[model samples]
Target: MSTGGGAHAAGLIRLLQSADFARAFTLAALGTGFASLLIGRTAGSVTLVTIVIALDVVGAAILFARRDELTLLRFAPTSLLAFLAWTLASTFWSFDRASTLRGWFELLAWGLLAIVIAHVRDTLQTVRALGDVMRWMLAISLGVEILSGILLDIPFPFLGVAGDIAFGGPIQGIFGTRNMLGFVAVMALITFTIEWLSQSISLRLSIFSLTLAALLAVLSASPTVLVIAVAVGAATLALALVRRSAPEHRRTTHTAIGAVVATVLIVCWFLRHLIIRLLDAASDFSIRADLWNEILDWVRPRPVQGWGWHGPWLRGDDASAPYPLNVINFTLDDRHASALNSFFDVLIQVGWGGLLLFGGMSVVAVVRSWLVAGERRSIVHAWTPLMLVALLVDSMFESFTLTGLGWMMLVVCAVRAGQSRSWRERIRDLAEGAPGGHGSGSSQDPLSGAR
Candidate 1:
């Protein structure tokens, strides 16, 4: 039985590697996106995502064999791996050890999928994969909303959506919430904008994508999404201006940026309430403040290591058990509140030690990716780093640092941005792209099947 299973697995992998099955990458990529973003957790969906992730692991393993052993470390950041290790280690101390173990596997599966995306020979290819996956996701999501609100003339109760089918829809589509739709739309805007700037896709295609993204942004009516869109625009404009600056004027450019940042921070600090008002945020932001206070109170005792990555604590009414850190009834299937801040989320789950590690990971990913973008001189590469920046910014409101699509995207960006290749390796990549070179090997640019 074991031999037969192994043989079947090998045969499947070989099929994926074959030229005729080149579209296999697209199918796998779309599955990863849908499993993480479009579909919610159900027994059937869970089984599907698990199988898709398993297949993705096989594909990743095949691609991993092509790169130099040393370069493989670039695919997994030290902080990220450490965080995962720590999270797993916490199971030893956690009251709900079984739950912690399950959560760890779930999180690691997403990380593995990201590593697969990072297998690309260049950041441009990585971005291309992202664009392809998102194009389908956003397009289908919009279609679902239209179907629910317009043709059906009712909410998609199954999807947990409620709203009219009008352009400014309250519709949640397949994402189950307007804010989630808004978040995806903003990301789509970023992807499409970069595709336009890099000339990676045709003008018509880019315009169409932009139109869909903009329309969704308006319809979703998510304050956080709109804020993120503005931030993305600001970041893009800033990158463009810096890109156009004379090489010798970099020092001056840095100084100007610092001043601008300082001014913006000061203005935001004084007008914090006004900012919240503009976004139509709830006065208490749906109990986030209350939850944050509870978390902080509980975290005071174990400032260093805290409750051992405990998940949805105190599921029952037993008083002896540690109360949920977030002050919620764990028995409830739907959770409407979180720490609502990513930094706090880390601090709550992993304590101060985990917080520092995550911070280091974020810093290394951003700085390294920024440097590589400059080296490649590809606008898409430049755009790649921005994705991480945008994720970090988005994290400020929604605790998106771990699990799901945001987490996976951060992992992909980190692997691509922080790569360090020698001159010999650079020459090899150029040669590999040449007509007569070892053309299109698995180790170098295997995912360019679409291109």
Candidate 2:
């Protein structure tokens, strides 16, 4: 190659490795990852996947160029890598290797996006990026709902707009379902709340953002939204109590709160029927129960390794598709993308072992995030734990956490949590201080102060 050409290529690489470029890439990645559903529904799966692949490729190039600035030990959480490895390993025994391989690629795509954001941005910056993305996506969703339900007075079947906003709907918005919209709204509520507490955004804008999220959450009419709202509210209060306590007493307080929460969960489980009736979700629960039962029947045979990771159970409402999930739906005379339960989805896909890994990853991330949130001085630290709580709570009723924006958010939270409090960080710290240690203490701080 000519000297000029070489210099030009080197300059481009340097540009890609710059901090400014990293920040912009993080924001763009968040926007694209969060809008996966809308993109898929509006354009097509092929288009959505193509965009993800393109973004992943660019993110990879940037990360590669900036490799020297990153600490290899802290690249990602061990639990997350284990879960991903198990997911990839499932392909060997998959009923459809090609489909499983594609699903794994999608998983890696989102995981890579989350990892890039974690490395490039601190908690407050990440929160701001998400807040911006949520504002636009939520606004677009509401606008689409308004356009279809009012101006056009017609359903946008392609985008999953049912024109139900005129009736004060159960509106699906740009998300494919009312439940998904509700889930995103809950996430928006959390992000907006953090943005408000941190004062990263304007007071007027925060209020407006909060109002938008609350309105869509209500209009979406998802029962899980109500449950998630209550859970997050309780968590906020609990976190506040923990934060205000004396540092020495926080551990005791944590134990007491955990005990109370455990007791309440047990009681709620026993009274679940009454709660279901109160939420007017009996019908929805019944439908989900049927799907769960069918999924269990399929899971029993492959209880060890599962039927393998097939992601979203295959597209289309075709009964003759011969896909396992499609077959289950056909048997139940229902049409759904997932089993409607994240745990069940994991169990049926990667079996009990995969379920354990997924659960461990979630539990560890939540614990780490929760402890850090209570201990940290900045309120911004609370965002990760609160978001994880909402994701896990909603996972019980909807399998949204298994794919799309839900999965991306889950990965981001887990990565952030792991960065803040993990054995890897502790080991690196020790190594940095050891005699003759070459460690430069260059590991990125996930909570590098509030913005």
Candidate 3:
């Protein structure tokens, strides 16, 4: 009787230590943050970002306190460590001190979240959790967008801060600008596609959600977002097709089709200047081009470690270069924010060494995820293609690395890599639980065949 009681207690403990708590906390953190983004007066303020970061930190602390029950910290592979180092170096050399400091704090919070996610959950569950968080975030963003459209006449609470716009219709959101709204909508669209492929819920529902998100994206009218959404969507679909093909036919078909599609896209982009034209539609595109050139010129003289943190732009007037006047104008003007491209911004600030280290780390992360997906048949495998496509799309027109979203996605991908399982393991678990294996009599053997 005592032995039975002890066993029962152990089982209860195990249940408590399972992934559900971590998943719930993650969803809560994301939901609150999205809500704040949609409704908070200070959309990008430290106060709002702080609240979410605090919650994540608390969640991580709890997981660490119960470290014996979690599996995430043990799975910190070498690539992740290298990535973290690169992130730290970037943080150290951030051109905007305040913005960079905020970014560093956010990164630490997310790192803790990643550890918790890895410790308590497997890859399939991680993807499912991410899907849930994104779904809720999308729903909230959609509600906010609709509200913005409807409440055009009166200052409707949080809508006031976003201000009024005249791009065919009112485009107001907590993000305070049409471009940011469009970017967020594009992210929603990607999440919608991922959820669709995972079949986490009904196909009909996924389709409906995706349609709504796409509509919102179009209404926002950011050409960059629209073009990226299409490109990433296409790439993700193609990769999915390849990944799901029969093993014998997959390699040849994937290679042939991938090469042809890539060649066609590259040819069109170069010959017709597809991307350039799309970017030209935005009023700020010219500014970005000038800015990129300015950064290049600045980097030429001080190639290594460039100018220290906040050096080039801050010392705009004094810096001698072809684009110094442009730099001075950009720095003095509040209308133009930091450089529009993240790579060039970092390159000018941190030089080749910083760029290579950070860029190499990002590449390693992508390669690791791909390799892991190849060995697994989980929802995480479905995530890899979408994530890669999204990253590529983001890199083209925006300073993706500067955004919190980029790090968030990276943490999610790393956790997925550590938690993914082999196809055989998934199959066996499914088979043993098809209602005929052992029933309730083998409660103690739930994972008997898993290993």
Residues 1-451, candidate 3, lDDT per residue (tens digit)? 9999999977755554555655676666555544554534544445666776677766666565556543432345455565455545655554445644444565566566665555555555555666676666556555665555455534455444332333343353555456656776776776666677677768987888778677667766676776677776676666666667776886686578668778977896676555566556635666776667766877897686644333123212234322333464555453333456656755765677656755664665555455444434554455654565566566656664444555555565654543342233444556877532222122121121221
Which residue pairs collide, candidate 2? Answer: none
Lowest lDDT 10-residue stretch of candidate 1: 437-446
Output the lDDT of residue 301, model 3.
Answer: 78
User: On lDDT, who's better, 1 or 3?
Assistant: 1
Candidate 1 structure quality by residue, lDDT tens digits, 234-258: 7677666766777678558757875
TM-score (C-alpha, index-matched) for candidate 3: 0.72
| RMSD over all Cα atoms, model 1 | 6.2
Where is model 3 more than 4 Å wrong at Cα?
1-18, 32-46, 69-74, 87-102, 152-172, 244-258, 261-265, 272-275, 278-282, 306-335, 371-380, 418-451
Residue 450 lDDT (model 2): 26
- Clashes counted in candidate 1 amount to 2
Q: Which pairs clash in the backbone of model 3?
A: 71-119, 72-119, 342-399
lDDT of each: 0.65, 0.86, 0.56
